[model samples]
Target: MASASTANRWLRPEVYPLFAAVGVAVGICGFQLVRNICINPEVRVSKEGRSAGVLENYAEGEKYAEHGLRKFLRTRAPEIMPSINRFFADPK
Candidate 1:
């Protein structure tokens, strides 16, 4: 059989990437959970007397409301494109 140190050396590098991937996945999941909780739609409806769900109740004479992400993107696209273009431009 191979020596213990030799076996460990072979195993460590293989395991390190797996551990790093798992850590990144866990961090992403945690961030998503917190974001969803913070943007809870129920709280907005209860406090503002408006439907905060994805679909608005336009049939009941309430104004239609776009999703927060869409609204932000639409309003900020002009401002965001310049920054994105600058980041991708040639450094020379």
Candidate 2:
């Protein structure tokens, strides 16, 4: 009778790839199941509301940054607009 180690050694190496393939398929299925359960669309509205509230809390900061960017672009428009117009006018 073969020893345990010898029996294991006798197993074909080709079986390893089959086992790995099965493991990957099972892992993918488990990940998809977990993602579906955690992010079901029924709770999307609540998630969006929470994210919106967070954004609202920083509204003043965003508004100031937006105004600064707009002012900076307005001041630089003469320098930037010509290049942009030239680039778009003819791709070739």
For candidate 1, list the clashing residue pairs, or say none: none
Q: Global lDDT of each model?
A: 0.63, 0.65
List model 1 lDDT by residue over 1-92, tens digit each.
46988878757877888889989999999987785556644334254445444545355322223556667788764654786787878485
Best by TM-score: 1
In terms of lDDT, model 1 sits at 0.63
Candidate maximizing lDDT: 2
Question: TM-score of each candidate?
Answer: 0.36, 0.35
Per-residue lDDT over 19-81 for candidate 2, one digit per residue giving the tens place of the 0 to 100 score: 889899999999867755555332235655556543433554555446655877776746547
Q: Could you give the C-alpha RMSD of every candidate to the true structure, in order shown?
A: 8.9, 14.6
